[model samples]
Target chain A: MSALPEVEIRIGGIDVGVEHDALLASTPGAGACVLFTGAVRGEGGLGALEALELEHYPGMAEESIASVVAEARTRWSVGAVRVIHRVGRLLPGELIVLVGVASAHRAEAFAAAEFVMDYLKTRAPIWKKEIGSGAERWIECRERDADAAARWIGQHTPTGESA
Target chain B: MLKLRFFASIREKLGQGSLDVRAAPDVVDVASLVRHLDAGPMPGCAATLLADNSLVAINRQLASPSTSVEDGDEIAFYPPVTGG
Candidate 1:
């Protein structure tokens, strides 16, 4: 049988740039890889946000993410999954989160990456507070996020099966 | 004893990270747990802190109101996750 899927979870800020090369070198024979990076925005959506303060349940946050990655593995033939979510104070335009998935095919890699991100947004035990212009407010989950995760609920019957 | 933990905005508002209280007869599930907390020191907490958007987890797993709770379980309440 193939080796167990690789999973990594980081809770603090670290150099995520090196993770790409690391995943490629570690996972031999993988044909496709997908990487998604989320960054903080300075303006627009949540007002003139200067920085984001992310808070998470110390133990539950990591556990929740691990479970999300595990679920992705069951639905797709993923090889290595690395997720890093930065907590504490994060300035605008800073890297907030990274999701990398490697697989033998592009379809599985792409689908799995999206699936992991969708679940992470809704299910993870992390929250964000926007700070800027003498105002600070906690951000709430968007309806679209729940809808995104809901789309994958009944579609887990396998690749070729009716979804 | 049942543990009630709060995070993010709810934690900030509640002014504490967690509280341990004996699980009374009515505190057998998340729904009942909310009721117990609501009637305590933090009045209107169930309405504000446990709003419709609040997320609940039992034993570190995401759970719903119907999920059963027992002694020694950790119940965490927080706002919707915004992490990517």
Candidate 2:
């Protein structure tokens, strides 16, 4: 069987350079490599957000990401898909999630990366709890994200969708 | 026997992380299992796991309400994903 995409859910910092090197190394022949990282914004809800906590469904979380990466691969001419998501308490500016895709062409890489990100936003079994002074609320799924994911449904059927 | 799990706000609302549903002949599919769970031990469970509200996975793979369930299946219920 082919190798499944690299997916991780850990508590700590992610070395952006190290991940870039690994992705580039894996898909040396690819012409374009696109990497996207999501960081905790200091401002959300009300007041200065002190920290963000991510809760994931352990085994299901990894599996969901893999499923979407697999879907991305089927829809695009993709080479490598790497996803890293951090859990537990996180402060503002700390990187929370990273999605890296490598493809033979720039457009493919860009499209696949965005598709994976959009799918992940509305489907993966992960949640963000924003913590601010005397207030904490679980981040609700946004309408924009659901719409982003919806556009892909009819354009091309993403096979192996678990959810 | 079925292993059930909950995460994020669903877990918080359910007041627990996991629950075990005893195997029953009537609990044959995802829909039945969800009905059992909702009407059984943890009430309010059905509200979160409905087709439009939350996501459910059978054995670590995404599943719909009608997906079949077996004795050893691992099922999880959680809200719409908000990750990047």
Per-candidate TM equals 0.86, 0.86
Stretches of model 2 off by over 4 angstroms after superposition:
A1-5, A154-163, B38-40, B43-52
Candidate 1, B1-84: lDDT as tens digits: 998899998888878889998889988789888888878756677875558877889999879988999999999888878877
Report the lDDT tens digits of candidate 1 across residue range A1-163: 2232344344456566567666666667777778988998887345798898888888787778889889998988877788888888888888888888877777887888899899999877888889888888888679999999999987853462222
Tens-digit lDDT string for candidate 2 (A1-163): 1253489899979998877777777885777789999999999985799999899888778877888888888888777778999999999999999999876677777778889889888877889999998899999889999999889886853332221
Query: Model 1 in CAPRI terms: which quality?
Result: medium
Score each candidate by Cα lDDT. 0.80, 0.83
Candidate 2: which docking quality band? medium
Error of 1 at A98 (Å): 0.5
